[model samples]
Target chain A: MKSNEPSFYEEVRVNGISRSDFLKFCTTMAAFMGLEASGVGQIVKALESKPRLPVIWFHFQECTCCSESFIRASHPIVASIVLDKISLDYQETLMAASGVQAEEAYKTVMQKFPGEYIVMVEGSIPTENEAYCCIGGRSALQILEEAVANCKAVVAWGNCASAGCVQAARPNPTGAQPVHKVISGKPVINVQGCPPIADVMAGVVVHLLTFDRIPQLDELGRPKAFYSRRVHDTCYRRANFDAGLFVESFDDEGAKRGYCLYKMGCKGPVTYNSCGIIKWNDGISYPIQSGHPCIGCSEAGFWDNGPFYQHLPSIAGFGIETTADKIGLGLGIATAVGVAGHAIVTNVRKHKEITNTPETVAEPETKKV
Target chain B: MRSRTNPMREVHVWELPVRLYHWVNALCITGLCITGYIIGNPPALMNGTEAYFNYWFGTIRFIHFLSAFLFFFNFLFRIYWGFAGNEFAKWTNFIPLKRSQWKEIMDVIKVDILQVTHKKIDSIGHNSLASVIYFITFLIFLLQCLTGFGMYSAMSNSFLPKLFAWIVPLLGGDIHARQLHHILMWAFILFAIVHVYLVFYHDYIERRGITSSMIGGWKFIEEDVYERHETESKEKAEK
Candidate 1:
């Protein structure tokens, strides 16, 4: 696949994209990466000179939603140029080669590229048993470790590969783990979402190709350009949250009035993502804009955070979904009852003590020696 | 029947600063609990006016944060006073170092929990067992402050709350820190109920003005108990 390939700029030109259109793509990529206008020229120069980056995308215990999101990206250049430009050596879902031929291509890329290729992980790796999710007689964990041994960087594609999503939720039977937990020593960039926004995925790739470095990341290893602010911080309905106008239920008047969904269990306040700003489907609308609350899918252990419709999560340790109100009210009632019973006994005991004591004659007040 | 008199001596226990801290902290805890509850589970207020005019939730959060500051500063004052104030308020009194203090603690448990009314254990300051409980409560108070400030750090541009931003990540995340903060409020509420009940119960049994001591800083001790306290203080001073 890598034999005699032209550079990204040449490939785009061959695909009928004009030089001006390619420059516009570079500017959009720079802006998406939160870079200054000067970065656009640098991106153009990099794409014009450097060959396409060789990427080996791996699939594990996942639904392939990340690949679906990436292919369905709204930009024409994203689908036609960037995806095609990257010499994606081996992807089980997207590539035409399979069986011995696919394995041969993967080995060839690993040998030829060595430390230059990027390893993109699309889902969590199940370590409990190799049979849980195996590809070509090898476990996901084994393949992931082998794939990233000498790669330049690792990109965790979505929540599954970054935070172990639903497969690693409470009572996880497969013992699934995220990519970073499995591979160390390499720079692991997490594009975290249930399925991260398509444009965001494209932007990360563009930034990596142009700068020849991983984008600046937050404490969670997510690209800071996309995850720096929480959903609540930039929400259009934030004014309603501050004003205390909350939707009591899904079909109430507050819902019709476009009140905040906080009371209906919106996780926007705790979730960090670019959905509120970048939006989805070519900046059409996001989930919150469509009147549904954020489920905090980008966060760690979101599946175990509790029901999506409840406002506050139940106390975590209790086996059932027991709320703070139930516990507090129960304890308060018990204490009141105990106090009332104890008061009765104390009064009775005091009455008995008073009755048992005999009267004595009082002496004139005098100072003790 | 012959009549006799038992003379009692009055001793000052709590200082002005300590008493002031006690009441102000009580008020702050009450305010914090109420406002924190509202913040966590906000009610759906009827929308009659413009959204700008309806700042009830904002006001609730402001009150919670204000009470948090008062709670934090009052706790700091108490810690300082434990080092600089009277013997009863000193840090040494809280630590169960002496054999006598340990014995008094057991005796207090026997009388209070076991309901053995015949035992008469007397001390001018806080009982050893009560001091230990207060010490633990102080630690919980510090935890509440840390988690509270950690949650505020994200919203606040101020320097003080920002100092605790590390706590959120350390405790797993903001939601975990919030759970801890909320649970500790219940701990304080439970402590208050037991504390007030025991204070009144001891006042009835000991007749030492236990409840009133916090108000006027005076405790009525028997003559024998006063002599013993005087000799102990003199020995401490000599040492």
Candidate 2:
């Protein structure tokens, strides 16, 4: 079955891209993967000869943003070549077939490819009830288990699939679980972001196609190349952050001067992503560059961390979401009042005791120990 | 109640290392709390000066990280001193393991919290309740060091900070670790307030020269108190 599949080079040529363009794409992919120039030839050879890998893309409880991001990739070839070459047999958003035809195609791909295919899960799997998110007739959890049962590896495409995004935020209504939690014993490569950078998505696929294995992952199971450095480390506004020049509000003078948005609750320091470096829309701009503080959409439980406009979450134990300042100040004031009251009470009691007591006779001095 | 005017006998309690650790730890915690608060909620210092000239925030962070190191090492010194120093500073004294220690803890609580001052405190060093509280604070200090270094691991390339990098992920990521670290600062602040107040309170009531003992290492105890401590040590040695 695999022998009948056309290689990436053949597919690209048939799709109207020239040999030079394909080689250039390979080189670019190699660089994005953090491979040296010497690895470019290896990528070229692999793509030129290796059969296109079968992929079954699953969408669970999501907004279809990952699919939108993938389709709108800045590089035209990413859609025209990489997407074309992937033999994407099952993606609800992108696949043309629907109803029985789509279900048939999914079944055929699973049966024929078995362990040879890769599973690309784009959203979190809902476990609350089967009725919450269903495809064809099966729940997302049921569908994911069947699809990932024999896949070579699973690539969790975005924050939803990687860390459950907003759907799995605090008080998660759907009991949404990321792919890693649902699937076990398989390498789950997380390309995390609200809608992860398009090139990053393509790069992970390219690495899989070329290397025939999962990429190195960080502790959070994200690709190390893109997720290792914090967004703050590579942010253009880092100098401003270090210098303590911050935008006080959305329309402040500091905002106009391109100051750091940390005071306005930019979570770049804690969030790890390639946004500051690789950037979005082909390196045009990112959240910080566009005068918006990062919402920390990439990190786990980002939604519950705090408000996007505030620096820190008001700890929950207080009656409402209150900042440390309010709580600390209140405690300090209360303590001061208590101390004053206690001092007054002690003074009065001491005065009464002193007046009641008579002068005591001096005792003989004991020998020093 | 016998005479109330007996001359006090001075006994050296805190050693040189203990006194040094106390003041240095106090200074380091103060520095950490101030700079840590700024780091968490930075002020919008929008001075018209060039970004290069205004490195005040960077200086604040530098001082925070520096004091963190000092605090960590100072704590380690205290831990070592607990093992090697005199009986007053020994690990056994802080553990609150014995039945007598528990009694002392209750007695101290009665005097301090319940406002019942009938029972007398006989120990020359830290009372049982204070020692237990300090032990708990030491545990908190260790946690602070772990989470602080874990957050620093991302920014720093040093091997020491790198060792703590796992703490972030293990504690459910950087944001949670930071939150825990930030909240613990308040614990220290509350501890400091109560600790200082209680020290002065005990000094006034017992007249053992509590505050100055931290500086001079000598605590003035009544003759009976000194004899009791001496006899207790002699009994323990014989046992």
Candidate 3:
């Protein structure tokens, strides 16, 4: 720890936040991380003693939704204390420094806190061309490589950094790839979502700060605390899905009844996220709650999964006949027609042979007689 | 000079275990395909009933999963029977390791496909080409199991289905794995169609009672053909 740097507790105290509110913030973060009551104490102790963790947030081929979501953490303590207390050394979107000055600050942070700082990447990197995304005349790839070179751990902020979001969808013109693909040898915590829940982002930071290591991640590198279950599993309307009652269309009677959106092409069955448990925009409502089906923004390659309004995707290489059932029906009809033709040929051949056999037999019999 | 007429003789071809496995497998596949298709494209049955009043969709998924387990077990049993059953049902028939087996495939293709010849294939069991196709079908069955159970793991809390969880990520995600699984269901349906047609065709042309053989566990082969097969088996055993 640096001798002169103030700890997170001191920063909170200096910012006019009461000790009780700061403790409450810790408790909320612990609960969001799916931790037991004991976890709150650990977070408190870590925040009080440890020096503020240095973070460098980078932006590349992204929409800055992650930054927007982060500032709107809902809990006032999170936006005011936790985020402010974190010694955020360099953030392109949030920081006031720009041009040569911003580049200088980024470089200074890398040198001053080498191997001690955290790197939170907010978007994907374009490997197809360096010109696709650049800042300060440096390519995104170059800046990302430099930022992640000596970081303690890398946090891939949203779906863009986790799974290459829309920019990396089918026919990707930029050849954009996720953060994990570009960086290696460091623990990359993928916070998956088009724009991950603000609390989830705070919860991840809390987990890292409290445990001094990355949380348990699933096979796709998403935190297990939030990504362990599918959105459908925890949905409030799951009973409706099981009941076979579904909203047929946006303006239908079923839509007014708030039925399950499964038939409306909800990707909740496949998407893994905490949207159902922690609703968006301060737990007010999620996509399904507001009469919109989940687009599966958290999942990888969701853009290519198919149309948002259709449940089943058309099979990719099947030309005009896209759906699996359509192709199957076509194949079935072709086989039936082929079989009938074969059967007709077999019968014709048999009839000719039977007719010819009697003539040959009569000729042999006459010769013998 | 050969005999003027060759008498047909009954050969015990399909063992009891083989016959049971066949019927059970057929039933399981039918159940799985029907339930699986419904899961993929569920019909919208809108009723004013409360959510708790309807458990039909849940039951349909349960049936799909139940048939999947049965299908998986039936497939495993057939693989075991391939080793334990008669020479005609042996694993050797499915794998074209021998030059004679390859030649048999070419010969059958000539007769069945090219239609250049009307000569009959002399095997008393499944023809060589059909065995190869079955082998491929078995591979597809394995893929179906991995993907089906892989998706099931997300909904299930048991240890068995969780074992196949790795397949979901390996195939890209839940949706891709599901897409592959659904496409292969159609493969099974197509295989069934061709298989049934060939069985009927072979029964009519050869008068071998091929269709009834699966049920009765016997095939009627010409005496000379059966004798030749016996001699060939003995020679192979000796070698």
Task: Give the candidate number with the greatest lDDT.
Answer: 3
In the range A147-245, model 2's lDDT, one tens digit per residue, is 888889999989899989988987889999999998898899999988999888988988888889999999999999888988999999999988999
Query: Where is the poorest 10-residue window by lDDT in model 2 chain B?
Result: B111-120
lDDT of 2 at B165: 95
Clashing pairs in 3: none
In model 1, the runs with Cα more than 4 Å from the true position are A1-5, A316-319, A348-369, B1-6, B95-102, B237-239
TM-score of chain A of 1: 0.90
Docking band of candidate 1 = acceptable
lDDT of each: 0.82, 0.83, 0.85
Q: Candidate 2 lDDT, tens digit per residue, B118-178?
A: 3456778888999999999999999999999999999899998998999998886788888
Task: List candidate 3 segments past 4 Å from native.
Answer: A81-87, A319-321, A350-369, B1-6
Candidate scoring better on TM-score of 1 and 3: 3
Residues B1-239, candidate 3: write the lDDT tens digits: 42223367999999998999889889989898898888877787746667878988899999888888988888998999899888888999999999988998998887665555655578888889989998999999999999999999998889889999999988878888878888899998988888899888777766678999999998889777888888988998999
Q: If the candidates were sorted by their DockQ against the true structure, best first, what order would they fall in?
A: 3, 2, 1
Docking class of 2: acceptable
Candidate 3 docks with a DockQ of 0.46
**For candidate 1, what's the RMSD?**
4.4
Q: Give one digit per residue, the lDDT tens place, for model 3 in A1-369.
A: 585788778887888889998988898888888889998899999988887778888889999998888888867766754357533567887677788888787788789989988898999999989799998888999989988899899999999999999999988899999999988899999999989999999889878877899999999999999999999999999998888888878998778888889878899998889899988888898999999999999999998887887777777787632777788889989998988898887766544323334343222112211
Q: Each prediction's Cα RMSD?
A: 4.4, 3.6, 4.0
Q: Model 1 over residues A1-369: C-alpha lDDT tens digits? A: 354768888888888989988888788778777889899999999888888888898889899998888777766788764357543578888777899988887888899989999998899988777689888898888888898998999999999999899999978899888998888999999999989988899889988888999999976789999887788888998988889888888888888888889888898887888888888888898888999999888887878776777665786686566766667767767776776676666665444332323221112211221
